[model samples]
Target: MKTYHGSCHCGAVKFRIVSPEITSGVRCNCSICQRKGALMTPHIYSPDDLVIESGEDQLSVYQFGTGVAKHYFCKVCGIYPFHQTMRKAGYYRVNVGCLEGVEPLQLQVEVFDGKRL
Candidate 1:
């Protein structure tokens, strides 16, 4: 597995997660995703592989539809850096933009038919 560092805008929220590879990610064309412009990477880490270094209070959550997915954003900067959804249950969808030292184009993306939900 590989370790990746990431943070929210304004540097308020910082975190790390482990993935088998950096190139795995998903892109959804759902209403909320299209509006938010989120490109998600599946974060399947054990408790030891994930850490939130700061800014817990600055985070906000949004849920809709079946309320199974929890979208997490920075309250200060209004950037949705990650989300927990029913699709992956315990896993998280980490926004690729939040990762440090990585370019969005470097990842391979699979399209999720979230619009049909």
Candidate 2:
């Protein structure tokens, strides 16, 4: 496992996550995810695995439908850093594009059928 640093587009929201070195990602086909088009971590993470380094107050959350998922983004920069999964409420998935040293487009991504959830 490795510790990874991530931040929003404007650096207004910074955080860290401990997970295996990221070699792949997930692309969700849900309505909201389709609009955002962000590549996310392949595995869900527990809250304990994530640490907010700074800008906690600058984070904004958006929810719709059943409101099971909580999409969190930087209020200042409009960049989504992570989100609470709808499949499991307290679990999270980090945005690969937001992580330092990660090239989201280079990742071999799996398509998730989130639209049916």
Best by lDDT: 2
Candidate 1 wrong stretches, greater than 4 Å: 42-48
Best by TM-score: 2
Tell me the tens digit of each residue's lDDT in model 2 across 68-94. Answer: 999998989899999999999999999
- In candidate 2, position 36 carries an lDDT of 96
Error of 1 at 26 (Å): 1.5
What are the Cα lDDT values of the candidates? 0.80, 0.94
**lDDT tens string, model 1, 62-97?**
999888878889988888888876665655778888
User: TM-score of each candidate?
Assistant: 0.87, 0.97
Taking all chains together, the TM-score of candidate 1 against the true structure is 0.87
What residue pairs are clashing in model 2? Answer: none
